[model samples]
Target: MNFKNNKILSALLLLTLTYTTGCYKDKSNDGLTPINTVQITDPLTAGTVTVFQGDVLRLKPTLTLSMTEKMDKLEFSWLVYNSNGQISLASPRAVISNQYELNYLIQGEPFILGEPYIVRLAVKDTETGVISYINYKVSIGNKYGTGWLVLEDKAGNGDLSFIFPDSTVEHQIYSSRNTAPLVGPKKLELTPFVITDGISDVGKRLYILAETGSQEYNYLTMVKKFDYGFEFYIAPTIQKPTVMTWLSTTSGSTRSANIGIVINNGKAHSNLVGGFPGTKKWGDIALTPQGTTNYSLAPYAVGGPGVAAMIYDNTSKRFYNIIAFSNTPGAGSLTAFPAIANTPGQFDLNNVGKTMIFQDSSDVVHTYNSVMKGDDNLPYLYRYKTANTSTATPNLSISNIQMNAPGILNYTAAASSTNTGHIYYSNANVISRYEVGSNSIVETYTFPAGENVTAIKYAKYNFNDKEAVKRARLVVGTWNGTEGKLYYFALSQTGSIGSYTKQFTGFGKIVDLAYKY
Candidate 1:
């Protein structure tokens, strides 16, 4: 019994075992029926499906199955999944019809707006006990997509209303959607759509300023995001917001990502809402041009879009400019406009001397216009021209003219035309159109006896709508002591007011109106 005898015996046993295993086979499906493959022919593959809320969603998938497989043998179910391709445990599987088609009303149940909810259909073979799954990414869109936002205040309580493109109004949207009502509305503005480092939201957002506090909301869905304090790393001690505006990187760009300026209690705060990280929060109050001197800034800023904004100082009665504030690179400091020796008596950028009534950019780039009240109790319009860059030098005064129209000093709200030389000002129940070039009132219209003008905004919408419908029109809001009405007046080519085109009633005192794109 040596090593050779042991090796020969092992080889014989291995051969016998291999022969037995190869000859014998399992008979599991030898005479059984084969499971039919469910082929969806319509959608071809799993993909995304888009549907607007409040609309009927119909999905009738075309399937190809074997003749032996009856329609009753296949049971179907629809369930929602998270955007990350995982089943949503918080959502209960809805009992959509067991039939091959799905016709369910999208009451916004289990479907969140702008979220990609994966809708899966489970097809189970009752007889064979086999199941097949097909997934479709479904997203809900808003019905109130593009429109205008109107802020109305009934005494101290504030609420919001949405006006559709066709002038259809849905009132009290803020109260109906949220648990608490908005209080003491001041202004309503929007943050432009921004794409920062390949990450962006579903749509723009609304920045609402009120007496209670400030908050941001989804422009499309009207859902609250966060309060004003969330935007600052170290929130400011005072929360009184006077004015806010989103600055664009270019004058013509629809998207903005450069800067946003907010004035809280005469102090300027800067927030970089888009672009690089570390700039999303609000920086400290901007410093004065001369670090040694303390100045009180006016509650308004003029220019942006890659240029430093011009702000007026009430203490010094002069003009100052500042760019976006950044802590890492040191906070932005206001710089004084350089003195101009060319114009002696006309105007001076460094020493305006007059109190600023209003300041805004004209339709032309680099051209800024301001309404100032002189020491003689008269209002004048002054124009300042500059370049459209961050490093541009302030030019000399373009034009300085005295507004010689009647009741100019008593004007409540003023809006200048973007494409013409017409300036519309409201005083009591009268709206006067004064031509800047002529220095005289061209036309004047008085509203009904008790209607006083509350807000006046020139229609300069950038939306791609009918030119005749949105162009060269003036939006005039009037209050008859108790109720408010919005009037639309079509302007002639010469800037003359024609008959009222349309009007909206059934609103409280309209405080502010902004056209949403």
Candidate 2:
């Protein structure tokens, strides 16, 4: 009876349930947005744009895009290529806006004169990953084709040619330009030197000085400036004199910015600038810096800007402690040079009486170094130890005790610190090197037969690598009568000729190689 009562009491206990709830409303609605299309306006036809080589190429395209999405940013890769679709030059990867403009230096291993090239714009949207390509056919004119410039036909006259660095494209640009008439066309035998304003930007007129390989080879008669038209500027009153450098104006928009072009055939440097009709006292080649009335002597083989500039006059057979730019306001005059001249007969006159000076691109002290041969056609390395004071005189001293490259031509050397560098030279049909350091004396690299070297050089063309080691490669100009080559020996960290990198063969007789920035 107790169990039944307990069960009945439990069952009789009534349970009541209640539910608590709140109504909810949708707070937001959304959907993905997308781009429709992108188009390039302006230059609808991409009319021909004639520009000098090494100049800046500005490409600002008006963009018309039909899209529903907001673009975070636009990425662009502007390239200049050939019909082969192989890229020759590429601009930096740029994160751009609608108003972004494209700027690129028209140089590198490609972009030749008189040839058709394509300027391609590969643009992409950061969000959608959609890319648009726009290409333009370009015909270059009067643009300096880069690489090795050959002065061939030393037999009767001379011819100018070029070879690109990639080792594929070579062209006879000079003749194609038909510039002979402008420079007084004549069958000439010359060992020429082409120099750009070392202190100026690219696109500056290139100066060509043709030296007669005759007596002393010191006679540098004609000074030709390569521009839209071949400008024959300086024909010094004193004929048969070599015009070295114009110590180009430190800065200016006019042509007479230089104090004077160092014009001498083994004589005193004429600092006298400015010319008057029938006036023998006038100076044709400006050696005077702008706004300076005083004369400035030009350096023959001189390099470096800040600490010091290495100076050597092949004609004078002398070098100076400092080139004495000493442009401390009033010092730009003849006093700009040292009172005493140092004639260190370190090089041979047979190299067309040519001298070369180089300093590390990254160094400020300007530890200048040079390489040349003497009467024996052998290469020698010379180092310029910086003087404690700028006023102290300095001359290049032989590095190794007796290190010499045998039967060398177009020999060049580059060094950063003392004895820390390498030298490369052309010997017959082979290439060789002379390593310098506090350690070993010299080392040589001999290429196989038929690798005939005609010229040698190393300049600012690091090619896409601004951080590239300054003298990473020893650039050599070579040819086998019909084919020209721009060969280089890549140097190792220890300054040894590590490997044979790349070379361009085609043109003919790569006589010399120089770089414009």
Candidate 3:
């Protein structure tokens, strides 16, 4: 073969292959489609938004789609971005909702309280396979995060005043949020951890008991969640609620057990809730050891972390030890206290004959104090030192003394602090401090004319120890016939009030106060 001819043919073959494969073509597509993107005319402001836990979050936004886009062809979804501000791949993103209008309860979400998370709304047009997103930073809060609840009587109607941690007051919050009025306000108590909803986690609750009716509200919102009668299988015939209190005992840092005692028309009802097989209703009236005797209980009870409650039967005029916390409904009963001999400074718990006027317990001293009135028309102070109820029989000790202090008989509102030796009582406009150790009045203060002390409470906030100064405060409520005022005084070590630290007014006949956490 001729070498030059063969080489020329090889070069021509290489040139032909390059022109057909490597050279790019410049041609417009004949039948290709452009993306149909939807536009949102209004979006949730693209910043941090706050929502309260357990509240309904409803968000609706009007959208302006492209001319070619149709509402039926759009798909929507909501998802939370991971910590890196992107959709997570290690874990599947759960779809919060798949609707244009979002309505959901802020519960059971992995997001933590007071922490911000990036939530994204995705809108897709299937025709163009394109998605648009709206992102918002959301944080969860509690409406009743931390405050003091003041239950008042406004012209014979029940009202509530909330005091924020910053000392801002919200008046008539209960009446504003609820349509059904709370009438004849009597007592307000916060229950220990309870299962408000059988599905949610354990939480505290607020009970507002009154002469007209009693009801339970969400501690976080003050919204009526359940009527007090709902807590009873068979509602009481006479729904006269005087008092309700929590019972619990602690050993070291562990709360061993807890229950609630409710006094309605002098009958006692007890229940243990917030756990498996939790019976979330009041049982039948508590029965005494004596068969068939309908003994009425005093309207006051004393129990705390280190002490079990002691109930006083005014019919028998004696004290009894409460049975252990039980899950069986209607099994609450009272047992007779072991009889002890009367001593110089102590009295027998089984045979004492006195009507309990006011009683409370202190976790610091593990002691319960009571101011009782005798049949002879005299007042006495009784102290009971209780041991932790970890054993079968707890060792109980008691001390009794007749209150001979000045203004003791004229006591209108009275309160004593934990481990403090002073008992503060009010006689109309005058507030007198009596020393329990010396059985004498130590200090006294008289308010301006026309102001009568209505309620006096000693705040013992166990949740926030940072509020140490506040825990030592003595909250005094006064009414000048029209408007009520709350005065918070920082009590000294000796229980003397020089002046008030804070005063919130504009309430109506403050009858009761409780700290909410």
After TM-score superposition, what is the CA distance of residue 284 in candidate 3 from its true location, in Å?
A: 1.4
What TM-score does each of the candidates earn? 0.76, 0.48, 0.77
lDDT of candidate 3 over 50-114, digit per residue (tens): 88876776776667765553788899997864444344445345678899888878764565455
Clashing pairs in 2: 167-504, 220-241, 258-288, 259-286, 259-287, 259-288, 260-286, 260-287, 260-288
Using lDDT as the measure, which candidate wins?
A: 3
The global Cα lDDT (0 to 1) of model 2 is 0.43
- Candidate 1, 233-258: lDDT as tens digits: 67778888877665554556565555
Report the alpha-carbon TM-score of model 1 versus the true structure. Answer: 0.76
Predicted candidate 2 versus true structure: per-residue lDDT over 311-416, tens digit per residue: 4545333343223334353322222233324344432221223333322322223344455444554544555433323445423232323344444344332223
Error of 2 at 164 (Å): 4.6
Give the 10-residue window scoring lowest on summed lDDT in candidate 3. 192-201
Ranking by TM-score: 3, 1, 2
Error of 2 at 163 (Å): 4.1
